[model samples]
Each structure stands twice: as C-alpha cells, then as structure tokens.
Target: MSLMDYTDQWLSVVQPQISQGSSWLADLRQGAVEQFATQGLPHARLENWKYTDVKALAKREFVLPKNAATQADALVAETSLALDGIRLVFVNGLFSAAHSQLDALPKGANVLPLADNANVAKTLLGQVAAANFSGFTALNLAAWQDGVVIDLAANTVVEMPIYLQFVSTEHTDACLIQPRILIKAGVYAQATVVEHFAGAEEAANFTNVVTEVDLADGAQITHYKLQQESVHQYHIASLHVQQQRDSRFTSHNICLGGKLARQDIQVELNAEGAEVNLNGLYLGNGRQHLDNHTLVNHNAPHTNSNEDYKGILNDRSRGVFNGRVVVHKNAQKIEAHQSNGNLLLSDKAEIDTKPELEIYADDVKCSHGSTTGQLDENALFALRSRGLDEAMARGLLTLAFANEVIDRIEIPAVHDRIELAVAGRLPEKFNLKGLV
Candidate 1:
C-alpha cells in the first residue's frame, strides 16, 4: 500500500478539488505527486512493464473520485455508446454539463471544458507528457478528474469527430478515473478525436488516462480509440505525440473491453516531412487481458512511419504486442514500417508478440514484424464446403482477420462503431456483421 501511502492518499483527496484555480496548476499537480512517490506503481518489474502485470492492480484500496457518484442509470449507461460529433460527457470523472454538446463550436475553435480551460494548457501542458512518463503517467499527472482542452486554430478545419465519452459506475469505494487530454494543432489545422470508454457492468472501476497531442507545422491529426470498459473494469491509457514540419498523424486503436487493458503509444517524428500512421485492433474473450505498447521515433529527415497491429484471441485470453521503431542518427531519408499480427482462437488462447527495429540511420527504411497463427485450416475446410456452418466458418475467417484492422476505419459512424464492436467480441456471434 506504499508509494508513500499512494502519494498520501492521493494528495489528501485530490488537493482540495483539482488544485484550486492554478498556480501553474499548483505546480503541475505538485509535480505529479512527487513523481508518484518516485516511480512506484507499474509492476512486472518494468521492462516496459514486462508483459503487463499491475500487481493485482497495485494492491487495490484506491480512491480519487472527487464527485460523479452519478448513477440513476447514468443516462441509460452513457447513451448506449453515442456518437455524433462535438460531444463531451464524463460521468464518473466529472464534467457532464448535463450530457454535453458544445453548440457546434467554430470561430477560433478552442473546445474548452477542462474545468475552466486548464490555464489554456500552460505552454503545451507538461510539454508532451513528461512528468516522469509512467507509473500511469504519474497517476495521470497526479489525479486528474476532468479534461479536454483542444485548441486548434491555424487553418482550422474540424468537420466533426470530437467525442470524448467516459462513463463508469457502481463504485462502493476503490475508484480512480483520471482523464487528462490536451490537443493543440494549429498551422494548417485539421482534426479528428474520438475516445470512448464505458463501464458499469459490475464496475470494478479504475481508468487512468492521459492524452497529449501537439502537431503544428502543416498540422493534421486523427486519433480514435475505443476501449470498451467493464469486464470488471481497469484500463490504462497513454498517447503522447509531438510532430512538426509537414505534420500529419493518424492512429486508430480499438481494444475491446478490459479485465486489464493497457495502451501506451508514443510518436515523435520531430520535423522534416513528418508523417505517422498507426492502426491497431485487439479483441479477446474470457479471462481477458489485452496490452499494446507502441513507440515510433524517426526524429526528422523526410520522416514517414506506418504501423499495423491486430490481435484476436478467445477463451483463456491473453494478448500483448510491443512495437518499436527508431531511426534517429541523422534520420536520413527515413521510412519506417512495423507490423504485429496474432489470432489464437483458444487452444487456451495466448499471444505475446513483439516487433522492433532500431536503425541509427544510414539512409534508412526500417521494418519490423511479428506473427502468431490460427484459423485457415485450409480456410476452415473451405467454409465447410460452402454450406457455412462451424460457427459460420470461424466467423468468416475471424471477420476476415479483423478486416485487416477494420478496413482502415475512415469514419462511417466511426466505421460502424468498429464493425459492431468487433462483432460483439466474437465467440461465434451469429450473422457476424450480418452475413457481411
């Protein structure tokens, strides 16, 4: 129970309600509670948290909820996963503005609601995530309870897609839902941001989130993440990106629910002709535990990066993918690619895939790969000679191997709500996408 008594019972109940109106946000929340009492919670003796273990979720007994004990069905369990632009609602972690809708914001867009604009992100808020980046980003910058301060202006183009909905309920005590998101994209601006995390199915809540994105020069950003909470919730998230020159960043991560889910994606292209794309998909059945950790740093010089991640596991579920790509040193003519693929379909399902490439540039074009198999026993007996049974031929080849990361989701209602939440986490869900 010690990380200095979990940072003194989390700053004696979140420092008098969100560090009272800024003194540089009370020194950035007391320097992230003294760096979570000097790097404490993040177990598996950390090698990038070696195969994800949170030591029984850092020995439970947690708290830091500062009001949001809401639940008269929490607006029918968060509008059954609603989506239709510019919507921001957070039930368990404050900020609801009666289930928000910001009147289609524009005209010098600055999507506030970080409880009084969080001092307008005092110089890019913690300058792209570094309050000792871990131990849950120092307990989400030491206990955050509300967020969303996106300031895009330069050549502002919003065209919808700013939805951050986080809802959790049923907490008798053992709460912790931290949300801190700050996005700043100006020069040549364009945006898309969607993050949906749900809970309340016997909510054993704990969602620690941190998102910081700043891309200026030639700016363009698209990030979508959906982590379906409450398999007995506990989800950890982190996405930190900083890019420049010709900047363009894209990421789509869909990890269905969590008994224990982890996502840490860090991208730094720096300048030159920055470009980054990362697409991921993780689905697991009972005994669920999904982990995805990605790091891409080209550091300039005609930089371009692309990564793809996919995983599908059934019962006895376990999946982890660690993808890394580094091309620094002059970064000469850089181009990096990484891929991790897994499909285990229960033979006591399990996957621990890793794809890494570190090239100290020499006119670089780096590549990384990892693959795990199952299905395709001659295309599942050729779809059982075309009559299509055998659980609809392994759910149409596991939804065509998860439609290769859901056919690069280009927002058709966030791609049919991620193809019906990855076909309702397939365990033979019939008409999986209704006969395609």
Candidate 2:
C-alpha cells in the first residue's frame, strides 16, 4: 500500500469508529487529520529527517486490528516493575482498566484517562504538543483514542512514581496505534513517571505516540522511558516539554529493540533559572536501526541544559544521533552542554553522530561534541592480563562504557534492569550476566 492508500483507509475506516468527542475536540481532530493527509510522512528530503527515512512506514497498510486485552493484562503482570505506585495499562492503544491500579491518589489531582477528563483535557490538549512538530505527531493528535492525563495540584508531592505500560499483542499486526500522554504539574509540585513500551515477539506493530509536559514554577518532573518492542515492530515517538521559572525536567530514554525506530525530543526553557537534562542509551544488533534526535532551546536567562546519549551497535545494525542546543538572543548567563558517544562491535556496524550548538548570546557558555569508535583494545587487554578470558574481558569493557549513563539512574531497580539488558545484548560467549 502507498501513503495515500493508508491515509484513506485510516480516515474512512478507523476515524469513523472512534467516538467523536466534544465540538472543539472534533474540530481539532478534523484539522489534524487534514494536515497529516496533506503533508504525508517525513522523508529524507526534510533536513530534520535526512539521516532517518520513513518511506517503508508510509507504504505499510495500516489497519486497526482487534486485540485481546487479556494478553495485555498478562503481559503487564509479568513485565511491570514491582514498585509501590499506580499503574495505567494500555492494550493495543486502548485503555485497560482491569489491570490498572489507581486505588490512591493525591488530593485535588487529576490522574485518569485523557478522554475521560474533559475539563482538564480541553484546557491543555494540543496546547503544549502542537500538531506541526511532525507528521506522526499530527496523526497521533488526530487519532489518539485514549491516554493518561496527569494534573497535579499546587505544592503536591507524589511519593510513588507513576507507571505507564503500553503493550502490543500478536493480534496487532499491521495495526496503527496512536496514544497521547499529557502531564501538567502545578507550582512547586514534584513527581516521577516511568513509561514502558513493549510488544509480543510475533507482532509487527506500528506505534506512533506523542507526550506533552507543562511544568509550572518551581515544579520538578523526572521521566524514564524503556522501549523494548518487538524486533519486527516500527516505533516513532516525540516528547515536547515546556518549563517555567525555576522548574526542572529530566529524562532517561533507553532504546533496546525495534526494526526501524526513531525518537524526537525537544525541550523549551521559557523562564529564568529553568533547568533540564536528557540522557539516552540505545543498543542494536541483527540489522536493527535506531535514531535519536534532541533539541534544547534556552529562551530565558540563567537557564541550563545537559544532554548525553550513547549507542552500542553490533552485527549489521545502524544508529543515528543528532543533538542541538540553541542559546537564543538576550538569553545571557545560560549554560548548555551536549555529548554523544557510540561503540561499534562489528566492522559492518555503522553510526552517524552529529552534535550542534547555536549561540546568539555573547555571555553564554555552550559546548557540543560527538565521538564514535570501537571498544578500547588496550582496556580489553588489560582485563585479559588480570586472568579474565577474552570474551569476559570484552564484555566487561563494553559494559563499563555503557555504564557511564546507567550509573546516573538513581532508582536501583531501573538501574539493574538497564544493566541486565545491556549485558544481554553482548555476544553469547561474553557471559557477564550476574556480574552486572
């Protein structure tokens, strides 16, 4: 199928099935659909999508397949972390309340499905994550049926982190699943959120998602994303964040699986004293392709941002990293730093890394760098001389290289999970399972 064919099918079959909400929402959805159909998918011709192409995604036939919610419940039960927090589950883009745990919530907070909370949804929907960010984002804005809406009251503190589980089943083949996530933090509020995306090994699901976050003055939010989807799946997601005065926002993105995966993140510091940090790790092998793109805008004085992304590619896999930091005019006293490091384990493995810095202010400090190469042979040999075999030594060296980002995770369970996944990506002979 071609791009037009898939878009026609979505508009004719899928759009009519989802219940039309209020008049304003209906208008927004209508406009977004028109925008997506006209513009189509992002291609290599576009500078932002030059390194990563989505022609295949545009050619695939998109159908809304019926999924068995029971499988998703079982998947969440087996995969979710054992944390003391509220869990929101989604099965093939539909909300699954049976498996969700929302017994307790802070007073005056709105934590529910986005469609269910019309009052809060109307006030902020499409306000932060504008539709023109990308084609997939516009499509998600049009077809997002259900999503999580988190609205915190002033000075509120969520003791436990929130868990969001999105699972795809074998029945999700050739499906078009679009989910939206909207988070609003009140003044001085604090919260942590973890988002996990995965699918059945047999399913070749297509997931297009958008997450919008708005932080009020002095609010803090830490977001952790773990993407371990099926190797046959195609995943595209974008995160848009807006920070106010003295607000803080941090992100940890771990990408481990997907046939063609791309992630786009943009953060805007709109007020003085705002701060942001972005950390990411991606591992690929067996012909997988992973792409990560980030942008930080220092729109106010005294703002700060730090970004670090690492990639490990083996076999014939490929990786791409493009990070840019912009210090706007009059944004004096701003400081921004960005770095991308990659390790290629095979001769055929390829990595394209570009770090860019745009500074219009004279009194600002900004720096960006990118480095890509093979594992340190000297370090490997040093480990070998300490009585460790070649395979074990190689595994140790690679793990240590990736651990620079993993060690920054404060949550013990998340750190251990990432460590285990990193070790498992190594060759079979390099057995460093429990050592991590």
Say which candidate scores most in TM-score. Answer: 2
How big is the positional error of residue 312 in model 1, measured in Å on the Cα after superposition?
8.9
Candidate 2 lDDT score at position 177 = 78
TM-score per candidate: 0.34, 0.96
- lDDT per model, in order? 0.81, 0.85
Q: Candidate 1 at residue 384, lDDT?
A: 88
The per-residue C-alpha lDDT of model 1 at residue 201 equals: 75
Q: Each prediction's Cα RMSD?
A: 20.2, 1.8
Query: What lDDT is obtained when candidate 1 is compared to the true structure?
Result: 0.81
Residue 221 C-alpha lDDT in model 1: 91
Instruction: Supply the TM-score for candidate 2.
Output: 0.96
lDDT of 2: 0.85
Please give the RMSD of candidate 2 to the true structure. Answer: 1.8
Best by lDDT: 2
**Tens-digit lDDT string for candidate 1 (1-436):** 5334455555565565556557887777777877877776766767888888886776676676656634524543453455665888787777877677888977767897786787777777778988787877876786686788899989998988888887777778857888889999999999898888876778787888889999999999999988888788889999999999998999999998889999999999899998999999999889989999989888888989999999998889898999888888998998888888888877998988878788887997777778787777998998889888878788888878888888888877767767877886787554665654
